[model samples]
Target: MKKVNQFASSKHILALAAIAAGIALPPQAVMASQITHVVQQAGAVKGTVVDSKGEPIIGATIKVKGDAKNGTITDLDGNFTLNVKPGTEIEISYIGYKNQVVKAGSSPIKVMMQDDSQSLNEVVVVGFGTQKKVNLTGSVGLATSKDIESRPVGSAVQALQGVVPGLNIDTGNYGGDLNASKSISIRGTGTLDSNQSKGDPLILIDGMEGDLNAINPQDIESISVLKDAAASSIYGSRAPFGVILVTTKSGKAGRVQVNYNTNLRWNTPLNMPDMMNSHQYATFFDQAEFNGSGNHLYGDEERKKIWDYMTGASDVFVEEGSGGKWNYDHTYANIDWLNQYFKHNSFSQEHNASISGGSDKVTFYASGNYLSQGGFLRYGTDNSERFNFTGKINAKLSKYVTVGYNARWTRKNYSRPTTVTGDNFYSHVLRRARPVRAMYDPNGYLMSDINYIDAL
Candidate 1:
């Protein structure tokens, strides 16, 4: 009984102490540690550095005060975030823009950087890297993505044709394999590790080694080529042929964008020569036999009969001595050979889809393409099939740490050996022979091989 009474009295005293402490404690002190820490946290610094008209000044300069190591260049969007020590000072400057300095607090800071000092067109990426046009000391050529997006090629270098001067591009014979793609050459110079001077250009993506074709053209923001030896010297041994720098597309801060691009095309044959008709064909073949270097396959009587038929007077002429209803007339099958083998029209189709968006803490981008194309060859060859995808995501973890990842994958199939297939196709379609005519006579196929003709 004594022990129970003692416990009840102690419990009542503890309850009264708790009530007093709660009433005396500060409202914030009563809250959880996590909520209080969050309230006192430092925010981020963000802004779109732009021209007076609101155009983003991509590749501009931004830095933390007194810290060369703590600096970053503005992206195409002219947006940047500097997570300085909770209260570090930042200096924002560009070649033509007035410099600005500001201090950070627990909340994110937004600044709309305006410029009047540098002309809008006076800045671009050069060999040494992002620089102002007025500050450029090297030769550089900037190419737009819209100019060369029409062609569907397997490599990025091929897309740059004619856009950049001095860069030579060609798809040499598939060396030993027919499936090999073309080779890329810059400036048409260099003969190292090769007896040939067809060295390819040095391709750089985001200042790193990469293939251009692997990137989706829609995802490309721009391309810069360093052609002059002086401008390309930074590439050292790899720059003998010159260098090509490609910048890929990036996410923009705003509502998500959904884009769709569609295209369809038809190829029509042209410039084909007129072929002889049934009668003309018979006459030509008769002459071929009479004046041909090889022994004649038919007698004079047979020749006369065939010649008469070709002159639009195809009456069987059995020499004056022979008598019978013997009249030779050319067959219809022999005249329309060419049209039977080649098609008059073919079609091609391309489809593309893309989605991009971002939030305050993260940004994402993704795209895909599907293509089906047919060729202009006689045989149903040259068809192509392809599929490609690319995606990327950027997440900001803190004021100083960020994580990002990007990936691309592609699969393609194409037909190209049809052109080199040669004479068999030509003879079957262009030869003045009737369908009844045998493709091969006793001794190996009778048609003369045309391979040696183009040789000389």
Candidate 2:
């Protein structure tokens, strides 16, 4: 025992003297030092993300395993450089593609992303909530903002024309009017009572009742048309005809973005009547009257005067009037009232601006829109102006809970000449203004009243 203790003391003294002389450590210490050197191997790791077909995948996310904050996105060339430890695992992910985890190395890495079929499933908004399109049993039609954003239309209904089956939209009697009333019907008119149940479908914008025309087309994200009863069962009788669900755009967690868009358009009437001159009108009516009662409505002298005046043989401008109370020789005046009162094309313009951005905890979006639409009239006060503003904000309060607020305001102003009672502008213009009459007298005074369109 005394010899063993003396041997251990001599070995300890020898090891301390070797360390003080800068001798190499034992095998276990050398192994530990090698491990420490490997762990300190941290630097920028470069990688390229590509699809199965070898095409570079732009905007792919490259994140460190278990570290969401330490991530980077692929640039336009599908290349990314992230500062991470060598041999560490990184997660590569992108929408419509499967996720991949690969070990980082000193050498460049190339990740091949396969297609994720589950990510291709389409999601649609329903009466209750959102559901996958394949899982929905009821009939629903979808229209994304891409379907209507490029259309030069003033109303959302106009943009949606012919986009969805069974969705009928009619511009109700006042065709071509800038502020014409629209009659919307889902499927068809099931009930005969047009007064109470006009077969108008229920339109909801972001879960609230709203006019389809009031919402800006640029602000729409998607439009879901609930056609069948099963699809609209959640809304009860309010959706008896059907329902239109409009989802608006929301902000995402990213850098702040501002967008502005504007468009100028001209609207031309397609269907205008071709009327006969005074000579043709007088001849046809005179012949009809003579054939009916064996007597002529216009004498031979009047007929000759109409024929001469309409043929440009007579240029004598003869008219008597003060203000719009003029009486001119109808048989001697051959005028085109429709062409004189209506313009060739009406001018319209729309402007939209929006700003959206947020952090992961809170997101916000706001937009404003303005539209100025001119009428078809040439001289009268006829035009329309519209304004729309929308704002939305959402905050994540907990892991599984989120709170949101949304507000929208819309205003429309229309101006036009008032017609007589029970008479609309179109019908009144067509009935009162004749091709055989004059819109102005020899004294340059108007030849029609304010209620009539001939005054224009």
Q: Which 10 consecutive residues of model 2 have the lowest summed lDDT?
A: 32-41
- Model 2 segments beyond 4 Å from truth? 1-120, 317-331, 420-422, 448-454
Clash tally, candidates in order: 11, 0
What is each predicted model's overall lDDT from 0 to 1? 0.60, 0.79
Q: How much is the lDDT of residue 403 in candidate 1? A: 85
Tell me, by TM-score, which candidate is best.
Answer: 2
* Model 1 C-alpha lDDT per residue in residues 1-456, reported as the tens digit of each score: 566556545544554565577634223222211221222224545555666677766556677888989766564346565556767787777765677777765565545565554454555666665876566666777776775676654345567777777666675643212244556765664666666655677788767788765566666777877777865568687777777788777666689999998778776667666766544555566578768766554445554554554565653322222253112222222224445445677687878788988987898989998877675554446677767798888889999998888887887887755433445444433443343222222334332332311211
* TM-score of candidate 1 against the unseen true structure: 0.53
Local lDDT at 424 for model 1 = 46
